[model samples]
Target: MLDFTCGRAIAVARNEKLQPELLKVGELASRAGVTVRALHHYDRIGLLKPSARAASGYRLYDRADVARLHQVQALRRFGLPLAEIGVVLDQPDTRFAGIVAEQITALRRQIAQASALRGQLVQLQRQLQLGAEPDLANWLSTLELMGAYDSYFTKEELQRLPFFQFDSQRDGIWGRLVARIAALMAGGVPAASRQARHLALHWMRRLERDTAANPDFAIRMGALMEGEPSARQRIGITPELKQYVIDALAENRLRIYANYLDADELRRMREHGGKHGKQWMTLIAAVHQQMHAGAAPGDPAVQALTREWFALFRQGAGDNPATLAKMRLAIDSEPALLAGSWINAEMLAFIRQSAATLQAPR
Candidate 1:
C-alpha cells in the first residue's frame, strides 16, 4: 500500500510540472522583455506568481502569469505607479484592450503637453540667445494663459508664436515709444500723427525686414501677443489700436505706390493718392530691397525697432525684450513672403490688427 501511494504522488508531481511547460519563468520574462529578476520580484510582491516548480527548483509560469506580466509592463510604460500597476493587474476581469486604449489616450495627452512645453522652451532659448532676461515665472504664467486658449489655437499656430526678450538700450527706446503712445491715447492724439504715422511706417518697414529674414515671424508674433488678453487690457488698447493699425496699413499701401509705381502706369491704374491697392506689395518691395542689399534682418537697427514696437504695442506695459529680439532674429533669417508671392492683403491686415490688439497700450 505504501509503495502504491508513493507511485501516485510521483505521477501527480510530474503532471503538475508538465502543465507549466508552455511558460518557464525565464522564457516568460524574456518574451515580455523584462529581466528574470523582475519576474522574481513580482512573484515576491504577490503581483504575479508562477503555477509550479520543476524538479530542478526552477519557477514555471502558466499563460495567466504571462498575461499578467504583459499588463504590468504596459502600465509601467504608461508611467503608472507600480502600486497602481499591481492593483490593475490583480483585477479579475480587466479588459486588456480597454486598458491599452486608456493608456494610449493618456500617452497622447502627455505627448501634446510635452510638445507645447518644448515650444515654450524654444522661445526661451531664442530669447536667451538675444541676451534677453526671460522670467521663468512669467513664462509659466504665460503657458497657463495659453492653456486656457488651447482650443482656440492649433498646434501649428502655437508653434509659430514668438516670446519676448529684453535688451537695455532697445528696452529704453521701447519704453519711450510706449510712453509716447500711452500719452497720445490718454490725450487723444490722432492715430495719424506725423510722428505716430512715422512711427507706424518705421514699424511696418522693420516688420518687413524682420519677416523677410524669418519666415516664421507671423506665427511667433501671434503666439507671444495672443496668449494673454489681460496683458492687452492693461495697456489701454481695447479698440483703438486695431483701427490705428488698419489706418497705418492703408497709409503704407499708399506709400508703396507713391515710391514704386511707374508714372504712366500709375495714371492708367487710376492710382488716386496711391491708395487701395495691395498692401503686401509694399512689404514685398521692402523685403526685396533688403535682400538686394544683403542686409541681416537682426542688424542692431532692426533689434532696436523690434524692441520699440514691442514696447509700443504693450502701451508702456512691459514685455520680454529678449524674446522679441530673438523673434526678430528668426524673422530676419526667413522672410514671411515666399519667393514668387507675398502674403495676401486680407491676411496681412488681419495679422496686423490682431498683433496690435494683443500689444495694445496698458
Candidate 2:
C-alpha cells in the first residue's frame, strides 16, 4: 500500500511496448484529410469511435480505427451515405465481401453509362465535322427526344427504323399523303367514301414502307403515337384520324376480296391471312427493299428471301394449285387490291424472277 509509484511506472513501461500507436482527433483528421468536427460527428453517429483515452481524457484513435476511417472515406467517394457506410462497415466479413462485389458492379454500370454518353458526343462531333452547322439548341432538343425514344423503343429497333435511313423521297411521299388526308378530313369526306378508300391504300403503302412491313414495328409505332403526346402532336395523326383510316382500310379490303372468293374461300383466306399476315408483310418488305437497292433476283440474298417467300406462300395457300390460281386471278384482275397491298405488279414480277432464279440449274 505504501510507495507503489515504482511498480506503476514499471507496468506503464511494459504496456507502452505492447500497445499500438494511437492518434488524437486532430492528428487523425489532419492525416486523413477530414475535419475534427467530422470525426466527432462520426463518433456521435456510432460510425467511428476512438478505442482509448489519453491521461488528459482526450479521445485516441488506434490503428484499427484509422483503417476504418479509410474505408469510410473510400465509400464516401463512391457516393455512399454515411448511414449506409456505417451499415456496410458493421456487416460480418462475408457480407462485407458481397458489398465489395456490389460496389464493383455499380462501378461497371457507371463506366457503361459514361461510354454511351461519350458515343453520343462523338456522333455529334462527326456531324459537325461533315460541314453541318452545329445548332446547339437543335442538338439539345434532339438529344432530349432521343432519350424520350429510348423509353418507347429498344436501341436495335430504333436503328432499323426509317428515321436513320435518310430517305427524302419516302418522307416527301409521307408528307404529301398526310396533307391529302388532312384536306379530305377538312372537306368532311366520310371514311366510307371512294376518296377515303383510295387514301387508305396510299396510307397502307406508306405505313408498310415506313415500318419495313414489320408488324411488330408498326404496332410499336402505333403505341408510341398513342402513348406519347409529343409524338402525336408532331405527327398530327390524331386518334380520330387514325381510327378513320383503320375503318376505311378494313371496309376497302373486304370489298376488294369479296369479288374473287366464295364464302368458304373467303373464310379460309381471312383465317390464313390473319395468322400469317405480319410475317408475309415482313418478307414482302424485305424483298421490296432489296429490289429498291438494285439487288439482282439471282443474288444469293434475294434467292434466300425468295425461298422463304415460297415456303410461306405454300403454308398459306396450301397444296391446292386451284386456290393459288384463283387468288392470283383476283390479284391480276383487281387494281384496288394492288393499290391497297404491298403485292403490286412490280413486286409480283420480282418474286417470280427470284423463283425462276432459284429453280434454274446452278
Candidate 3:
C-alpha cells in the first residue's frame, strides 16, 4: 500500500510539471514592456492580478493574466483611466465592440497627428538641406514656430523662404551687430554717425544675402513682423531698432551719393528715387521672380521687364548720361549700394542681356 501511494504521488508531480507555464512578475513586466512597479500597482488596483501564487507566496502570471495585462495597457494607451479600464474589462460583451470602435477612432486620430508631425519634420529636413543649421534649442523653437509660419505663408512659399537659413556663424554675427547698434544708440550716437553708417551697411548686406533670391521676402517679412508681435519678439527686432536701422541706411545712402553726385544731381536723384521708388520696387520684384523661375534673358517677359527697368533707371538717375554712368559706377564699386538696391551682378547681367535683345533689330 505504501509503495502504491508513493508511485501515485510521483505521477501527480510529473503531471503538474507538464501543465502550462507561468511567469513571475518581473518576467511578465519585461515581456509586456511595463515596469514591475506598474504590474504591482495593477495588481493592487485589481486591474491585472496574477492568476496564481507559488508556495513561496510569490505572484505568478499565467497566459490569461498576460492577455488581460495587454488589454489593460491598450486601454491605457487609448487614454482610458485605469478605473474605467477595469469597468470596461468587466463588461466584456457587446459593449466591448463599442469600446474597440472607440479605440480605433482614437488610433486614427493619433495616426493623423503623427502624419502631420512627420510632414513638419520633412519640411525642416528640406530647410536643413537648403543650408539651415539650427542647434537643438533653435531646432525646437523652429518646430514650435512652424505653425505660426503657416498663418503667414503658403506651403510652397514656405519651402522657398530662407527664413530658417541661419547658421551659427551668421547668427553670431547678427547678434554682435545688433548689440553694437544698441550700444551706439545708448551712447547717443547719431544715425548719421560714421560708426552707425558702417553697422547699417553690414545690416543691409546681411539682409540682402537673406532675401536676394526673392525680393518680396523683405516686404513679406516686414508684414509678418508688423502683424505678429510674437515674431518681433522672437526675432528681437523691435520697432525702435527697425526705425534706427532705416535712418542709418538713409545716411549710408547719402554718403554713397555724395561720393559721386553734385548738389544739383543729388537733389534730382533723391526726388526721382522717391517719386518712383514704389515702381522700382515692383520692377525689381518682377525681375527676381522671373530669374528665380529660370526665365532666360531673351524671354519676352524678361524683355518687357528690361524695358521697364531701363525706364525706371533713367528716371532715378536723372536721365543724364554722365549721372547714369556715375550711378552705375557707384553701384559697381559699392557692395553696400548693391545691397541697398537688392540687385546683384548676376541680376544686372540678366537685365543687360535682355536690354541688348530688346535693342536688337527686329
Candidate 4:
C-alpha cells in the first residue's frame, strides 16, 4: 500500500500560488520523493533555502524553494555536480535555453563514447564466442592500441569530426574519390599529372570546407595523425604526388595573394623533411601553406578567392548533392569567416535565395 498523503501535499503545493508558511521537513521530502537529508543538504548549500524556520529550528520550504529544488533536480539529470549546479543556478544572466543546449551537447558526447565502448565490447564477445583462445594479453593490448588512437582527440574534437552521409543518387561520389586517391597512391601516379593535380585540388577543397565548418578541424586532424607512423607509411603517398600537391598549392597561394614558405623556410622545411620521412612532411607543408594563404585578411584577392570558392561549391551541387546541401547550410549558418569578416547580409540573402532555387523540386 502506498500513502497518498505526500502526493496530495505536492498537489496542494503545485496548485496553490500562495507560499506555504511552513512545511515539515519529512513531509516536504516525502512530497518531493527525496530523503530528508537531501533536502537538508540543499538548504545548507544555499540552493533551496527555506522561507522560514520554526521556533524548534525546523526548515519550512515555500513556493520559491519548491521551484529552486525542481531546477536542481533537472540539472542533476544533466550529470552536473552539486557544486556546478549551484554555480549555474546562481548565475544571473544564464538563460535556461543556454543550460539546455550545454546539457544536450554533453548528452551527445556521452552517447558517442558509450556507443564506441559497446562496439569494442561486442567485438571481444564475438572473438570469445568463436572459441579462439581469448588471450587476455591480446585483449589488453588491443585496448591500449585503441586508447592511444583515441587519446589524440579531446571529446569535443571527436564530436566535431566531419560526418558525410552516402547518397545513392550521387552513386557514392565521396567513396569514389577516396578510392581514386588510394589507387593513385598505390599505382605510383605522378602528383604533377593532370589527374593527380585535380585529385589534390579536390582534397584541398574538402579540407577547406571541413576547416571552415569546424575551426578546430585542422588541430584535431594534426593530433590524430601525430606519432602514427604506421598510418602514414600505409598510405604511401608518393614523392611525385606530394610535389604535385605542393606545386598546386603554391600556385593557389599566389593567386590568393597569400605567401608560401619563403626560400629560407622552404629550405629548413625540406631539410626537416629529409630527417623524418620527407613525403608526409611535404604534403603537410603544402596544406599548411594553403591554410596560411587562406588566412590573409581584407585583401581583395582573398575576397575574390572566397567568392570563387563559393562558386565552385555551387557547381558541386550537381555532382555531390548531399555534400552540397551540407555546404549550403554551413555557408548560410556560419556567422563569420577566417579573418573577422562578418558574412555580409547581402551575401547571406543571396545564398538563401540560391539555396532555395537549388533545392526546388524538378
Candidate 5:
C-alpha cells in the first residue's frame, strides 16, 4: 500500500537523511536483478524514472524508487505486460489493494496450473523410474491427441471421456471400425441400406458410451467437430469422411421411414420439417429430457409430449386412416425413422405407447 500512494510525500518530508544513500542506475539494476538497459527503458516509459542526479550527471535512484521498482517487479512476476504495469503505477489514485489483489488472484491460478503440470510430470517420471518403458512415437502421438482435446474439451469433460481417462483398446476398435467402413465404401455399399445404417448405429453407440451418456458432452463434441475441422483432421476423421458417415445415418433413417409410408410421405415430411423445424426441435428435446428424468410412457408429462408430437405428425401427414396407419407402422417398425436423436429402441417404444394411451378411450 505504501508503494502506491502518499508514502513518497512522507518519506521526502521526514527522510532527508536517507538522500545520501541513493544508488546509481547500474548499482540499482544490479541489486534489483534487472538490466541497466531495462532501467533506462523503464525511465523512458515514465514507469520508474530515477529521482536524483549525481555531480557526474548519472541517474541516481533513492529508496522510494526501490520501493516502486519492487512493486513493478512483483507485477512482472505475475505475468502482466509492462504496459499494463505502467498504467497501474501511474494511477496513484487507484486502490493499492485492488491492484495487488488482482495480481494475487492471477498468481494463485497460475500456481495451481503449474502444480497440476508438475503432478503430471512426476507421474510420468515415476513410471519411468519404475522400469515402465515408453515408446517414443506413441508418447508423441499421445501428446498430439492431448493437445487436440485441450482445444475442445474442458478438464471435467476430459475426465469423463474414455479416450482421456480409460485404459482400453477403444482406439484400436475405432481404427478397425473406420477401416471396415472405408472398405465397405470401396466395395460400393450404399449409405442408405440397413447394413450401413447398423454400422452407423454401432459407431454412434460406441461414442455415446465413451462419453458416459452425457448428452451435453456429446453436444459439445459435435460442435467441436463442426467448428474445428483441423481437430477432426488430426484425429483422422476428415470432413469428407465425416459427412459421408453422417449422411449415411440420416439417409438410412429416411429409408427406414419410407419402408412403411411412401417416399412422398418422407419427402413432404422433410419439406414441412424445414418450415416447422424449431417447434419440432423443441418438442423432441422435451421428450428426450423427460425420458432422462425417469418419466415412464404413461407419465402425464410424457403423454403431453406425445400429444404435441402426434399433433405435429398429423399436421404433416394427413389424418387419413390409411396414412395414419402407415405412420404408426413406421413408428412401430424402426426407432431410427423418427427425426430426433437418441430416439432409439426404448425411447421409440415409450413414444408409441404414450401415443397409443393418449389416443385410447379416457
Candidate 6:
C-alpha cells in the first residue's frame, strides 16, 4: 500500500511540472505594452492573476493572462471608466459596442471645451500684443470672459474678430504708449502744448500700426468695448482717459497742419472742419484706410485723403479763415465740443504723425 501511494504522488508531481512555461510579470507587461504597476493592481483586485509562480517566487503569467490584459485595454480605449470596466470585463460581448459609442460621444464634448479654451488663449495673446498688460489676477480672470464670447463665436471665429487681428508687437507697444498718455493726462497736461502734441503724435503712429488703417475691425472692437464696461475698465479705458486722448490728438493734428497754412487759412479751416463735421468723419475713415494700407506719408492716396478733409474744412470757412478761428477758440474752451464725435484722439494722433512730412517749412 505504501509503494502504491508513493508512486501515485510522484505521477502527480510530474504532471504539474510538465505544464507549459509561464511569463514573469515584468516580461508580461513588456510584451503587453503595459506597466508592471498595472499588472500588480489587476492582481490585487483579483482581475488578472499569474498562472503560476517561478521557483524564485516571482509572479508568472501564461498566454491566457495576456488575452485578459488585451480585453482590459480594449475596454479602456472605448472610454470605459475603471469602475464600469470591472463589470463589463466579465461579459465583453454584450458591452463592447455600446461602451465605445458612449466614449466617442464623451470625447466630442471634451474636444469642444478644449477648443473653446484654445480660442480664449489666442484672443488673449492678441490682446497682450495689442498692449494689454494684465496683472496675474486679472489675466486669469480675463479667461473667464471666454464664456461670454462662446455664445457668439467659435474659437476660429474669435481669431478672425477685430479684437484679435492686430499685429501682436504693435499691439503690445500700444499698451505702453497708453500708460504714458494716461500719466501725462493725470498730471494736468495740456493737449494744446507742443510737448503734449508730441506725445499724441507718438501715440498715433502706434495706432496706425495696430489698425493698419482698417476701421471695420476697430469699429467692431470699439462697440464691444463700449458694451463691455468691465472689460474696458480692467484694461484702463476710462472716460477721462478717452477724452484726454481725443483732446490731445485734435490739438496735435491742428499743430502739424498749421505748418502748411497761413493764419487766415487756418481760421477758415477750423470753422468748416467743425461745420461740415460729417464730411470730416468721412475723411477720418479714409485716413484709417490709408493708415491700415500703410500708405507713405506722401502717398497719393494720403494726398487724396487730405484733399477731401481740406475741402470739408473749406466749405464752412468760405475758403479762408473767416469765423473758423473763433469756432476753434470756442471748441478749445469747452470740453463739451468733443462729447458727441466718433473721432478718437488716437486716430487724430495717427493722422498728425503720418501727415508730418506734408508740413511746409517753418
Each prediction's TM-score versus the true structure? 0.32, 0.41, 0.54, 0.42, 0.46, 0.41
Instruction: State each model's CA lDDT, in order.
Output: 0.51, 0.70, 0.73, 0.52, 0.68, 0.59
Candidate number with greatest TM-score = 3
Which scores greater on lDDT, model 3 or model 6?
3
| lDDT tens digits by residue: candidate 4, 1-362 | 12333443321243333333346678778867889999988888787788776555667676667767767876898789999999988889857766567777777767766765776576678887997666675556545544555666555555555421112323245446556866766687765456765676666656545444443455444444455544333333344444555554443322222123335433433333223223323333333343445543234443443444344433423334444454344444543221211124453444344334444321
Candidate 5: deviation at residue 107, Å?
28
**Model 1 lDDT per residue over 46-152, tens place:** 88888777666677665566666768877888798878888876678878998778777767656766765776687789999999998776666655555544544
Model 3, residue 67: distance off in Å is 32
Tens-digit lDDT track for model 3 on 1-362?
01112221111122234234567677667767889999999989999998876656667776678767767877888788999999889874725456567778767656755765675577679878989774575555545565677877776676456564434566578778888988998899999899998888888778767654566876676677777666765566788887788778776786798899998888876666646655776788899989989999999899988888887777766667788878878877877776666778999888888878878311
Candidate 1 clash total?
Answer: 31
After superposition, the stretches of candidate 1 with alpha carbons farther than 4 Å from their true spots are 1-41, 51-64, 73-93, 129-132, 135-140, 146-362
**Sort by lDDT, top down from the best:** 3, 2, 5, 6, 4, 1
Any runs in candidate 6 off by more than 4 Å, and if so which?
1-141, 144-172, 271-362
- Candidate 2 C-alpha lDDT tens digits along 261-318: 6777667655565456557767876887798789998899999988887778667556
For residue 54, model 2's alpha carbon misses the true position, in angstroms, by: 90
- The local distance difference test score of model 2 is 0.70
Off by over 4 Å in 4: 1-35, 50-67, 70-91, 133-155, 163-226, 229-362
Candidate 1, residue 148: the lDDT equals 48
Clashing residue pairs, backbone N/CA/C < 3 A, model 4: 191-241
